[model samples]
Target: MQVVGNALVALVAALHLYFLVLEMFLWTRPYGLKTFGNTAARARDSAVLAANQGLYNGFLAAGLVWGLAHPAPVFASQLKVFFLLCVIAAGLYGAATVSRKILLVQAAPAALALLVIWLG
Candidate 1:
């Protein structure tokens, strides 16, 4: 069970890292624009904002990894919940304000992580 929890946490961390790249570096490129549905100019204009958001995601990833590594008091599970909540909130806001697919791609993984950690 512990191993399963840690594995899920690790996967979440990696996913967030990929998110960091996609948002911060690739937002204007084919991959990011295809995923985010934005023009090149618009993506470039939003680069700074995406970097900021990506930074937060990176912090969340780091927290998950740290929590898994140190396992003092089920910190991984707790942080996973917290991080997923943040993603869920962002996804909701994005869906309401920006895009719906964000909810599917971003929130879904968080939801999956939450489920795995809780159920496994």
Candidate 2:
């Protein structure tokens, strides 16, 4: 169960990292435009904002990784909970403001990880 929970946490971290790449490096590219359903002009207009958003996603990923790598068990768990909650909050906000897909892709995984971690 612990292993499963940790793997889920890692998965969430990886997802955030992917988001960072998509938003920061590819927001104006064909792939990113397709991913976000943005026209080239719209993507170009919002590239700076997307890059900023991507930076925040990278921070989330970093926090999750730090939680996973922490030396102390109790502190590590605390870190994980904190970062997971942040992810959940961000996901919920994105779902409300941007797209419903965020609830499924971002919030659901973190919620599952949190449940497993709590159970473990």
Candidate 3:
């Protein structure tokens, strides 16, 4: 169970890292525009904002990675909890304001991992 929880954590971290790249580096690209359902013009106009959002995603990924790599077990768990909560919060907000898919894509995994961690 602990191993499962940790793997889930890693999965979440990887997702955020992918998000970071998509938003920061590909916001205006064809793939990014298609992924976000954005018009080319709209993507160009919002590119900077998307990049900024991507940077924050990178921070979240970094935090999760830090939590995973921490030397102390208890502290590591705390760190993971904090960052997972942050991810959940962000996902909820995105679901409300942006798209419901955010809840499924972003929050659900973290929630599952949190549950696994708690049980483990």
User: What lDDT is obtained when candidate 2 is compared to the true structure?
Assistant: 0.96
State the lDDT of candidate 3 residue by residue for 63-112, as single tens digits. Answer: 99998999999999999999999999999999999999999999999999
Model 3: colliding residue pairs = none
Choose the strongest candidate by lDDT: 2
RMSD of each: 2.2, 0.5, 0.5
lDDT of 2 by residue, 1-120 (tens): 989999999999999999999999999999999999999999999999999999999999999999999999899999999999999999999999989999999999999999999999
Candidate 1 has its poorest 10 consecutive residues by lDDT at 68-77
Q: Where is model 2 more than 4 Å wrong at Cα?
A: none
The superposed Cα distance between candidate 1 and the true structure at residue 52, in angstroms, equals 1.3
Comparing 1 with 2 on lDDT, the higher-scoring candidate is: 2
Winner on lDDT between 1 and 3 is 3
Give the least accurate 10-residue stretch of model 3, judged by summed lDDT: 111-120
State each model's CA lDDT, in order.
0.78, 0.96, 0.95
